[model samples]
Target chain A: MTDRSRDGLRPSLDQPRRGFMPRFNIALVLPAQLTMMAVVIVPTLIILWLAITDWQPTQAIPWYDATPVWFWNFYDLWYDERFVNAVGRTLFVVGVCVALELGLALGLALLFLDEWPWRRVAVSIIILPMMIIPVDAANAFFMLFNERGPINHMISLVIGAPFEFSWLSHPTWAMAPIMMAEVWQWTPLMFLLVLTGLMNLPQNQVRAAIVLGASPVRIFFKVMLPLLAPVISIALLIRSIETFKIFDPVYILTRGQPGGSTETISMFMYNGAFVYFRMGYIAAAALLVLVVVISVCLVLARPMTKHS
Target chain B: MDRKLELRALRKSFGDVEAVKGIDLALNRGEFLSLLGPSGCGKSTTLSLIAGFLQPDAGEILVDGKVVNRVSPRKRRIGLVFQDYAVFSKLSVRANLSFGLEAQRVPRLERDRAVAEISEKLNLNPILAARGGELNMSEMQRVALARVLVTKPELLLLDEPMSNLDAALRAKLRGELKQIQKELEQTVLYVTHDQVEALSMSDRIAVMRDGEILQDDSTEAIYRRPAERFVAEFIGDPPINMVTCTVTAEGGVVSVSTALHRNLPLGQGEIAPGQYLLAVRPHHFQASREAAAGTVGSEIRLVENFGAEHVLHVSYGDDLVAVVVAPGFAREGERIHLALHAEQAHLFDLESGQVIALQRREAAA
Candidate 1:
């Protein structure tokens, strides 16, 4: 239609000139490619190679004397009850924290949908927890759950008795405080995303549904929920991934105490690498965690991508 | 004789602005009534109030002689087709059609039958398996209509459903809508700002302005016997020509005089002699070449050819009057004589914008 397109009709004009063009493109991209190789690719390959070798950092043996064990570290991890329990506990925490955050955030978002005085101020206050650093948030909760803290004081007043318990010393009860801290720090993100989805819903369709005799509950489940599927899925996926790698709150609140009961996969990996100095085993375990995370992400992102 | 819906002094306001002032209307059973006005004339507000989407501030809405002012939209058996054709994009066409029936807890077999019947009638059976997001605009509109109609609502409210359509598609859908309404004998309340859609489809039309209904009458009477100058000017395509004149009563006859036309006799009516507006439609004025007695002479300033009819904008002294004539009857800069029939002209009070006197045909003859 135009001169350029007419020129494309000829075979000779379609061939690109052989000059410095290809080399120039390579030159432009070389820096980024080299940076990725040095920073990510080389380190990942070394970690992979080390994972299959039997090497002890504590020994004074040279690196060339290390022998290939061929997945003996991975095979030992399957039978390691502590490692297995740590993985299970991490999944449990992720499930409970994500569920609680999603439920509380959905409730808060729905409440903010209505008009009230000081609504903007209230929303700003609610989002403040998300802005605080995670370590600081964990420390704040750590102080709050102490023996003489306000939480114990409120509990004592409610039950008409002074109730006192060492929250970090108990084995099973230690996880509860860490989970509460995680939920409090992250629910606002879900609220912000879901509220945006709620506000952007097609208003005419809602009005039409009402006029066609759909009750409020029906409208929510049938119309609103289906429309919010993509947002809900994405929010849940992000929350699950972050909650699965939870470590700061556990370290601050419990330090994996009470016979390692509150230890997550991240804590186990950290102990293996730094505290126990099992470098080859930790590398093998880290690769396994990466595979698990990728599988979980793929599973969680399926519904969202399908909808879009 | 059966009154299907009635509104008594319905009123609404958003903050300081009164969206719908006190208004009263009665819709008969099986009659297609339209609320016709320009944008922001409260037509859509009235439709919302009737559909139970908004509660009237201080009035009563009666459906089948029962007050439903406190009823929520879900409880009121009313159907509304919005202007945007709000078809649920996530649902299949069949699912969208059966949404209302599903809400009412109709049995699956019966709901399926109803959906099939309505989809067939609306010619949407071919697209029933497709999702609503995949369909074109016309198909979306049909799905919206069928979704509402399947529930067999008592009263149907449509708010300019064809406003988003192209002209050709709109004309076709207009005929189909009218035909479907007639077949079902449904009590319908249609709202539109386009006068042509209102005039062509409505059994009776109510013209509104500034949140108030100025005139309500049959389509024929609204065109030929507009109650006020605003109604006359608003309803016609070329619009009505209005000239300021002074009325003088002499014995038993009343005559109006303007700067360009003198001593134009109007039929007898009890009108106080004062400044008034003389309104006449373009087609009602007679144009000729020869200067007849009692005719105003003017030179044509411009001529617009519109296939079957031509409109000549003629200038007389400082006033311009548009006269509709047959094609090839006049050219630019040609001298033509124009006369107005006494019965075809309307007189309104200049300040109040109300009809002061309308000449009777028999009396004028």
Candidate 2:
């Protein structure tokens, strides 16, 4: 409450106000936001700062030199073919994974548009794989494709012999299994976002389409798909960014097998910074990756951005 | 833009509750017909059935003397203007107008020509480039009409087109709509729950209730000579007041009796010995200028003076009735007498509430 309206007399004796003033005591807002800044914002800023500075937890001093800067780190990343290969591998893996995931998600979203018997059971089963923890669970994929795992054993039983097919030794086949694992774990997220978009679509537009005498297929292509573009791009960007930084599935499932064929850029950065203690190079690499992510996102978001 | 439309015994039911029990009506070419009803009266369902969104349980819908029950809505070639003004939000006014033409695969040259003419007719020239959703309510409504009219449909269906507008815009559009229909000689089927909409603009009105067409006739016939008690009550403003009565046989005249007064002879409805009710419209029941000869007895309960008019709220044995009159009236705790114009009064059967048919001497002669 302000001092001007002390007695609940809203009409002031000396004022003819046309706009608003603070209705409540605003002193309470300051301390509350200060606490959030200390807890959340400060830590986020420190991490971003640490990505640019040459700081290491194992070092005797937080900064190895008086002025901690890494000019050589930025130029050195250009010569690292292994890191570039890792970045290329991450892009390829996430690209194929998000594409297949969106196709399955859109199919499920459309299938669930109309009510049918046992729809709840089918939808629950489709989203079940995503609910499990990815770390302890990426090993489940490891178990499924293991040489003596149940799947190969089951296949051997079907063939009436203990078949010996190389499951995880080939580079070309190595990324395929990793991509499949990523799709299984993340398709449910795309399904959920796309389903929300489909459900919230303006029903009046659909009814107008029907009254205009459009076939169901034409309606899907002309109306539903174009409208669903926002959902697709949003799902693509979020899942791809999340997938590009993917480390757990590749780490636990394939362990960067077939001579680092399945190693993503994040895992490579983790090894560079933590395992080999190359803080300057990893910091420079992380900043470059951030720029790439932002540029990719901006490119994907151009159509949905309103010009006005 | 004009074609004869007829629905033959069309019925629609949802799970056990029938929304449109059975509707049958014929619309001649170039006539404007209004389907009038209260909420939940199945007027919208009847329009949807005619629009081919809902399939009838049993019956045929004929457009231009051909049965088309199986035809899809797009294939039906009918124009519909919805209440919310369903012009495409993504399309400009001109694009919205051209949508129906493009749907029918009109040639590019012909479609553009049709849109240009419709845009001019609806006075949407300045708003040709504006998005449909960005327009105000009145302009949006004009665009909706323009979009439908550009197709040159066989019949035009407007479903409560003005219900969402302000009262002022509704009146203005009502006149403009009627004038346009007259100028084009377009066959129109309009639906509204408002009696004012029906009475002001429609040539013929069909009053519906509980999924059945209670009465269908010309607007004047429906209002002046309401076929049922519900029609008489529902058709007028503030509704007609009804009171139960007993009609006793007298010396060549049947005496109508109520609790407030007794033995008033209204020669219009024949008096049957059974139970009945007397319905008096508020306008028909008036405070006589001077106590001349004969008048029914009523005491004043209250009087309300609006700047231009006064309403008399009177009570007669738990029946609160009102009488609206011009300004310059004051009667409080002062005795007042009321009279009923017998020719204007209606007698209804007490049990069924149906209006009793009156026999005219001119017809007999």
Candidate 3:
């Protein structure tokens, strides 16, 4: 017996002419490349050009006709106390929210590792907050933190008196609700990723540790945590970047009102560009925020990449 | 005498499936015992029970003469080397070795000394600072063994630690492992499916099937005098050949008859005249061209050569029998007469698959 092929290639009566392969490849990728250039690169260049100019929307002059006051917008932003304060506030909020989310997520992930009744149902319910629309969640928090809301009623019941505190009106209290909203919306993501990482860990190592007379706590610290370092770093990096750009909750809850205490950099940029109509200044501020976020992500992602 | 580890009627069931069914085992101090079985035969499950990783459904696991059925794995003082060489990838070899010691609150000086000694003994000094994930397979295995040995637990359990190595590397590590165990005099309960490993390294072997121990005896006894049909077939490479036969009693002597041969006197045995299964190892059958008085004629179907020896597959009626012979014995399609060594042939009860007593003539007689 010999090897046989039923699905063999057949000779065609008319053969098509050969074409240039590289040119065809270029043509195939041209649409996506053009879309990317038009949507991302062109606007970024326009923003860069506007950031160095003293262009005013109130003036009827074309953008190119405006005088290029090189470094003047940046110079103004350098001394702008509100912008500096917004940057600091943004960093503080990002730090608090990311740290809290990571801690809570890790705890929840570890809790979910145990066998319990309705664990799958609980996990599905826990991730529901992440799936809710940010603006709707912000509105829900707005109603829940009102003076006559259930939260205050519960507090009143706990303290044996009628308690009413301005959650969104007070400057110091405003950021707390906004940070809570941020943590609530994103903590589920961290929990999911960290749980996956924990599940994928080498189970044999844990078993070996158990048989070697290491206590449960020692096994967690020595074997599990070190193995989970890369995953935690990645989760932290993603959460930090998202938290640094926090805007929707702050916009809905406080709108940087009652003082500008809860004003994050994104909120400041929005108010500057649309409310204050300082487009050039906001562009410069936005560029600085982007640079800071990118640098922070690079620093945080180093250990993650190394471990992986 | 107090045994190092013992299990009394150990039973574990997962829902409807009984993983380990009422097993009782004991290990003598400084003895190397191997639980030999195919996969899912509950050998590893038995190890896990003794290691306290799994609680038995009913029974007691005693370590050093004390019942530890309720003890946690960490407090049981037993060491287990996993099949995958579970070295912590995030820690260095030195750190991995010192983790248990640190957990036990061993002093830094003593921990260092013990680490150094085990590393030198296992020849892991060169890679002590290397990350566990970076070492090669052999190095990882050595580090895994050293880490467990350094702790010096009362009982050590190995679950096919050499299953993942190349053939040559496995052979080399087998010798090293035996040497290390001997030098340390560690009480080991090794689990493996490979008969060669069990026969070569273990002082005693326990053959398991379907969650029960069929035979537990010295390695030589398990190999030479298998207690059952499963033991006879499962222990040797190319396995033992079996032929259905009938035992007949005449004049207080017992003889066997098969389809190919009749009235063959089996020296002596207290076996009732009934159906039986005769088992003989491939190497015990002698094949020759000259037809002997009591030989069965067979036609060689194929020949498998193995450097120093060759296995001849011969056809007798509708049954194929294998005979292991030295090289240059017989060619394929050759007519040969086969004779069984009466001393090496084993008779098993057909109904129960249990070995029957057989008495053979003395060599002097």
TM-score of chain B of each: 0.95, 0.92, 0.96
Per-residue lDDT of A188-281 in model 3, one digit per residue for the tens? 9999999999898998999888877888788888899999998889889888988888999999999988778889998998898889877777
> Which of the two, 1 or 2, has more TM-score?
1
Supply the global lDDT for candidate 2. 0.79
Report the Cα RMSD per candidate: 4.7, 5.2, 3.8
Tens digits of per-residue lDDT for model 1, B1-365: 89899999999998898988999999999999999999999999988888887888988999999999998888889889999888988789998999999889999999999999999999998999998778888899999999999999889999999998999999999999999999999889999998888988999999998788999898888987788778988998777888888898877578888767788887777778888888878887889998888787889999989889999998855778888999999899988888887567888888888887544646332
lDDT of candidate 2 at residue A302, scale 0 to 100:
78
The residue-by-residue lDDT of candidate 2 on A1-308, one tens digit each, is 47757675787656555434443334658788889999978865654565556666566556434234546556667887887898888888878888999999988899998889998898899898889898866888888888778878899999998876567777777676677778998999999899989988766566665666556776676567766777778888899889988888788867677787777898888778777776656767887898888888888777768533
lDDT tens per residue, model 3, B281-358: 898888888999778888999999988889999886578888998899889988989887756778898889999876
TM-score of each: 0.86, 0.83, 0.92
TM-score, candidate 3, is: 0.92
Number of the top DockQ candidate: 3
| Residue clash pairs of candidate 2 | none
Per-model CA lDDT versus the true structure: 0.88, 0.79, 0.88
**Candidate 3 stretches greater than 4 Å from native:** A1-34, A62-66, A147-164, B259-261, B270-274, B363-365
CA displacement after TM-score superposition, residue B123 of candidate 1 (Å): 1.7
